[model samples]
Target chain A: MPHDSAGHTPIDMPDDPDARIIRALKALLIGRGFFSADDVRRKIEELQSPAPARGAALVAAAWSDPAFRAHLLADGKVAAAERGVPVLEAGLIVVENTPSLHNLITCTLCSCYPRSLLGQPPPWYTSKAYRARSVRDPRGVLAELGWTPPRGIAIRVHDSTADMRYLVLPRRPDGTEGWPEGDLARLVTRDSMIGVAPALSPSAVGRDPSGI
Target chain B: MDRLRFAIGQRVRIRDLPVPGHMRTPRYVRGRTGEVTQYCGSFRNPETLAYGGNGMPTRGLYRVRLRQGDLWSGYRGSGQDTLEIEIYEHWLAEVGKGAPDAP
Candidate 1:
């Protein structure tokens, strides 16, 4: 499990040529004058591990408890801290997804994400197209991500800066009442937290015919 | 640049700085009206004109709120839905407060 500065684990990436290049650079830099590349490499490695499943439990609890949901929305960092999610002091804002409103976040300038909660950002998120089009045409971006908000729903696009990170708290899906936290965690994908996708219900999971 | 300060509900305009490479300031908000909703502290300006300009170490950060109606006049959605964005100090200026007229 890769651990970041905040002690949160990130998802692992498949080893590829790019990964090799990163490793080589780490070795080259550490072998020279730059500060211990090994330390940096270790931190990066920790960031690549799958994030702890603890956050899932909080989401699940919020799904079943309206009070908790309100608390989560009122002060997400505090609520998550109570749940042991290790909310970093990076000036993060938790935007809630409601039936009438949808929120999408992008770092037009750079990739400033809530790594402590959602783990590493997906590849599609770092794409130039996603960044450029997110603010200009958010509805189109959401559509491309397979989310079509109901008519009359407003979509707000937030561009994260270098200092502030943003996270989207997706609305609790239907047919999830009485579901256990362990079962609910499986439904929360990183994309949902970014507002590019919605949380999956049991029926939707593994229901894709293409095996995606 | 020094640390920037502003309060919630204070309207400000984003500056159009000529920065090379990619920057966090979206082009759309370059000269748009936004209000400071949250105060984010200082941090390294990622857009560090790497090619050689100023070697500043840190920049101020703040979260500004832009109403959908303000951003898009034809925006047909709820007026309460506002987009909050984080911006560096160098990217903002007092609204209607023109830059000093060059002598």
Candidate 2:
């Protein structure tokens, strides 16, 4: 295998425009005083390490503990930081789902997600179609996403338009009495925390080989 | 004392005025009436923050709710359904209170 200057085998990229552009940009930035290679690598590593699991753990903890829930509701940024979840400088506002109101999140202008907590956003979330329809019709969008709240419950859509980030504090499902926090965390999915769907229910959590 | 003009539960309308550069308020809710849900504290204006200028002028942030029927034409959802947006103080005005003026 022929290795490039970095001594790593060159990956397949005959016509990848972005790959070339990114490589050139990195070289230019490092050549100039804009950013060092280490800085870029550090940022990529940090982003890759963080995922929805962190948010799920927080939600699970909140479900079991009242005091932590109170603190989280009082000040989301502080609570997440206190629990060691690197609260991004961009403010995070946690909204709780209640029997009366259901919350839906969408970024109408752009694809600004809670990357600091959730590892990555699905492609559909950032698409223009979802961005437009979510604001125009939230209930229709929710049903398509497999989130069907009991009839007569109101849906509230939150458009993250600015520097602020939001995390949905999904209501705990019933019949989960005394479930261990670790097990409960499994019930939470990335989309559930994003308010696109409700947290996984006990009835739907079937045993798998990996014990999801 | 906080410099906020509207209190929680107050009925207000999102202004129809166009904003320069970037804006947090979506177009669908413009000129629509809604109730203030909660105060999200004062923060540097994002419109200015996006540009190179210093985002010095802080504005009160809020979570406002509007009925789904009010925004969408021929809406099928129950009248109880509502949509909430995080809007700045400058983009809202007191409505249904004696010829309310724009902010």
Candidate 3:
């Protein structure tokens, strides 16, 4: 392992072959004038800046407004564009969680996540275990992920293909009536939106709800 | 035809054949039959796109809904447990095409 010019370890870089290859590719592209270092950095920052906040904002708005929720379920792209969330480029469908039916999203072939709405997928979502198990045994998979829906509620797993993406609109947690959109949004976590867990209950709010 | 061939509520089965190249259909749902819940518009085939093809020729896609019991034996979930997946047209065949009153 080679040290940096300042002779300090870069925690950003762990000894990974993929990182070394990417660095080499970046250097080659820069040398060939195909892209500047600033361009790469800007792109990296753009991807890194995308978080679950966008999805949470949309969910919060929907929870507070029935019209918005109906619009989101009817047409996700238009609803997302209306909210300035930037999901219109791809086909998106928002599956709502009903009293008797639960919705779970997964991409079995590869990690075809809804990057436009929720940013990158959580690491476990891309793992083979999740991809295979989610389709075959969604309830069991949900149990493993620390969420077990009450019995008798049918679990419907959506296996997303490259053409279309699915987003889960988890039922709003209890005891949040009359809550403002912003506060309701705070309770929406990425895992909840992915259907592996439920939106944080009022008791679980004001603390790190992510079990990870 | 790019337009959807399978009407909503029609029954179809995912082909279980071994494809030689790229494919978007997951193996787990292969050969399983399901009802067409929605008509997803046409799109370029991912199978060809993965191989760097132009992907110009599009195929119809549908949201197929199936019961978990149909896909797995001894399903542990409630009897009403169901699943849905977006599958391309070419991979499906109508199950009861000649039956009377078949939609």
Candidate 4:
């Protein structure tokens, strides 16, 4: 029940312990001048600003330029920076999917995702069932998510158990040859970047020409 | 910053030690064997960091690849299926170097 320096407790504070702790810490940090209230607000804004488009842009560039693809696969943070995407994760790894291999990402311990590139993780990504089953039965989870790799193609699951955040560079769908990078980016959905689904097929993109 | 105990491609086993506090090592992989696929660089020990420790002399973090069949008794996927997890150096011990205390 300790009041902040203002001598007033947050009237709207929830009864939840975690939320209370967070609020208390925020007040202490601000009081100590670790960071101003505006800094926290701006950080929240930055985190919520970029959607999947940031990741899609990188995927499209990799699909279009072989050299850029090499750089992306080698150092994703640098690649993202080159394209104006700021990766705030400790490390960013871009895993590639191929004809014989498919990659799936899940944080078995917690929802450790490439948030800076792809925005906040989807609810399913943070669900307990997903955190458990994705490592135990990735193929089954992928199937439930509406994607199943072809027979003989292996599924490799990445468990974000530590500091590194993963972004799956799903294979570019066929029939996208000679397409502009922007149009190609339009086909890269958030699910594809998470490796739960493939990029939108050329025909599917054609169906939603406006992508509305 | 001492020499990393494990190297890429070296086989190691996750220590099955029961840690009481915050730890990044997952339970399922404990006592399981895997190959170090990549040396993900040194990082502050999260177990200590979680408790507000300085976590100095960072430990190495590695991407270890384990066979799905090896992890789960009834794994349904092909033998080629694998799971890659980031494991801290302290949580892993060299396979066959000295057997881990029996579970």
Interface RMSD of each: 2.7, 1.5, 1.1, 0.7
Q: Best-fitting candidate, measured by DockQ? A: 4
Name the lDDT value of residue A117 in candidate 1.
77
Off by over 4 Å in 2: A1-25, A207-212, B96-103
Q: lDDT of model 3 at residue A155?
A: 92
Candidate 3 clashes between residue pairs 3 or more apart in a chain or in different chains: none
Q: Could you give candidate 1's per-residue lDDT for residues A1-212 as a string of tens digits?
A: 76456866767976899998987887888888686966787887878663735456667777767798788777777788887776674755678888888888888776778778777877878889998878766777777778777767778788886666677777887776666667777788777888888888678765322232
Per-prediction TM-score of chain B? 0.79, 0.88, 0.86, 0.89
* Pairs with steric clashes in candidate 2: none
lDDT of each: 0.74, 0.83, 0.84, 0.88
**Which is the better candidate, 1 or 3, if ranked by DockQ?**
3
Q: How high is the lDDT of residue A110 in model 4?
A: 76
TM-score of each: 0.73, 0.85, 0.87, 0.87
Docking class of 3: medium
Model 4 spans with C-alpha error above 4 angstroms: A1-17, A20-39, A207-212, B99-103
RMSD of each: 8.9, 5.2, 5.7, 6.9
Weakest 10 consecutive residues, lDDT, candidate 2 chain B?
Answer: B94-103
Clashing pairs in 1: A2-A46, A3-A46, A10-A49, A11-A48, A11-A49, A109-B23, A109-B24
- lDDT pick, better of 1 and 2: 2
Candidate 3 residue runs with Cα over 4 Å from true position: A1-24, A206-212, B97-103
State the lDDT at B19 in candidate 1.
71
Model 2: per-residue Cα lDDT over A118-153, one tens digit each: 887889999999999887877788888776677677
